[model samples]
Target: MHIQLVRHATLRVAYKGRTLLVDPMLSLAGELPATVNTPNQRPNPGVELPMPAEEVLGGVDAILITHTHTDHLDEAAVKQLPKHLPIFCQPPDREKLQNHGFEQVIVVESEYVWEGIQLYRTGGRHGTGEIGEKMGPVSGFVLQAEGEPTLYLAGDTIWCEEVEHALKSHRPDVIVPFAGAAHFLVGDPITMTKEDIVQLAQAAPGSQVFVAHMEVWNHCLLSRDELREHLTNNHLSERVQVPQDGEKIEYKR
Candidate 1:
């Protein structure tokens, strides 16, 4: 199996004769609005896309979009992706993507199988009550390919009851969590905190945990070095992996 970490929350996964692009956000620098809301708010200073959108994503079989946030699903990528490519997303998000011109859209449910891979839905919350409602509903995904290791992709979420239930139900071989503890002014940290990641590593015994969605945006509070240190201190360094942008890792089973 080949997994390449492309930037904030974006990944390319290859397994079972298919390559799936998860959340392709390839916007030009300074195109996105400031993620952190404040009195003197500054716009988000976006990073340059490592490669041309088409060349990097040349032969993708499908796309998995967790949500419609601009950072996770940019308009440019949405327009550029082939209309024939199968797009997988939640029901509401499907409506949004469909409007953008994707001809094949799949509304992910609790469980579904597509292209030689099995996808299982895992619940996720964006934030607390009013704050979370403002953010919107989020869902995680568990993907399993025959003869390959199972992987769990935890979308933007904190350590909540629903997430715990999903972990208990299915023990995946790998876990990809959005860390960095992102916050916007008054609300508490919305995404997973460093401590939450430590707990996640403990919960899934022997599972290789890949931490993403950190450092790229201004709102994110944790750094790759800091997370690495925490994992080391807890004696969980071996299990935790923090990949840099444009980095790739392959796992064989």
Candidate 2:
């Protein structure tokens, strides 16, 4: 299996002879405005796409969206992706994608199968307290296919009971956690902080944890250096990988 960090929250994954694009935020750097109610108000997408947009989208068999947030599925992606491509998303986002003119919007309610890949929808809390409640519903996904390693993509969530449950139930071979410690001014981090990441690693010692959603947006406070440093301090660096933008990591099952 292969996974490429295509920028913040966006991932290009290859497994079971199929390529999937997850949460594609394809806008050029500075093309979008900053995230509101955050510390840094600088234009979003602090850096450019490491490769050309075409190259990033090339040979994608399907698209998987965790939610309808602009950062996850932006205007650029809506414009670039082919209308005929099958899109897998939660039920809440079905109407939104249909409104955007996508022809195939498959809602993964609990579980769904496409070709040889099996997708299982899981729950997540975007934040805590009122902020989390207001952030609305979010989801994570588990992918399994014959001759391929099980993969768990924990989308836009902190370390919570739901995540722990997924870890215990799925026992994934690889785990991707969105770890930026992103927050607004009033609330605690809306994404996984360093401590949360550590807890996750400890929870599932056997799974390889890959960090994503860092340093690209104004709201995300945790940088790659900081996360790596924390992991090194905790003696969990060897188990976790923090890839740079457009960097691809390969794994054998």
Candidate 3:
């Protein structure tokens, strides 16, 4: 199995004679607004899509969407993708994905099995408590292919009880989390903090935790180097990884 990180939460997963694109946000700089209902604004700065959405995504057998946020699912990606491609998403995003022309849209219940991959839907909180109300409910996906390692894709969420439940239930070999620590002028922190990540590693002992979603947006304040150092100091460096944009990593059993 080959997993390549393609900026933000976007990724290209190639396995079992198929390529799946997850959370593809392709747009030019200044093309869209930043945060919803906020005066804070900035340029999109564009995405480094592997190829044109129409070209590469045609070969995609499936699309796994974590959420419907613009940063994860852009208008450009929606317009260009083939209508025939099957879309797998949580209940909240099913209607939106189907409305966008995808004929086969499956709303994940407990687990959704496709080909040899078993995907489990786990609950997620957008922020701490009150802040989550503004951000909306979210979910993470735990993916496991026959003989391949299990992966837990922690969507836009903070470290909460639900996340801990997923970790204990799925026991993923790799935990891919959004670690940008995003915040607006109002709330506290919406995303996972560096301390939270360290706690995550400690909670799921022996699991390799991979961090992403940093530095791309101005609101995300955490840095990659700082996270690395924290992990190192905690004697958990080998168990955690922070990949750069376009970088690829594989897990072998």
Candidate 4:
């Protein structure tokens, strides 16, 4: 299987002769308003997409949207992606996408099969207490296919018990964590911190972890440099990857 980091949380997963686009924030820079009260409350995204949206969207067989957050699925994605393409998303986001006029919006509460790939929705806590509640419903996914790497795409979630459970239960070969320590400056991080990354690495020694959701978003406080540095200090540089935009990583097992 191959996964390309388009930008932010957007990724292109290729497996079994098919391609799936995940959390496509397919819009030009500065098109959307800034995230208010955050470190970079300036209009997002702070940088341009590394590749053209059309180029990235090419040949995508399906869409796996973790949630409805604009950073994951922006206005442009809603307008640009083919209306007929099948969209696999969480149950909470079913009506929202349907309202956007998509025809094949499949809500996978537990698991769903597309062609030959398996998609299982996993739980996480966006934040704790009141802040967490305001963050809305979110989900991660565990995908597996014959001859392809078992992938655990951890969505916009911080380090929590559910995360630990997912790691133990799935034992995925490849894991993608939205590891930007994203926060709007009012509350604690809404995503995993550097320490969280270290913990995940220690727990899942066999999993190839990819760190994402940094640099592009205004609220993402942790940079790739910091993440890399921390991991290196902890002797985890070889296991975890912090990919650049438009960079593709392939697992040939």
TM-score of each: 0.95, 0.99, 0.91, 0.98
For model 1, give the 10-residue run with minimal summed lDDT: 38-47
**Which one wins on TM-score?**
2
lDDT of 2 by residue, 110-131 (tens): 9999998999999999999999
Instruction: Rank candidates, TM-score, best first.
Output: 2, 4, 1, 3
Q: Predictions ranked by lDDT, top down?
A: 2, 4, 1, 3
Best candidate (score: lDDT): 2
- Between candidates 3 and 4, which one is better according to TM-score? 4
How many clashing pairs per prediction, in order?
Answer: 0, 0, 0, 0
Clashes counted in candidate 1 amount to 0
lDDT of 3 by residue, 1-253 (tens): 6677777787777766678888877775567756753334665633355445555465678888888888888898788766777788888777778778889998898898888888899988888757789778688999888778788999888899999999999998888888878887777677898988988889999688888777666577788888889888999888888888777888764
- RMSD (Cα, Å) for all candidates, in order, is 1.6, 0.6, 2.2, 0.9
Global CA lDDT computed for model 1: 0.83
lDDT of 1 by residue, 21-117 (tens): 9988877767777775732244543466666777658789999988888778878787778888898888778778878888999998788899789
Model-by-model lDDT, in order? 0.83, 0.94, 0.80, 0.91
Clashing pairs in 1: none
lDDT of 3 at 109: 85
For residue 147, model 2's alpha carbon misses the true position, in angstroms, by 1.1
lDDT at residue 51 of model 4 (Cα atoms): 82
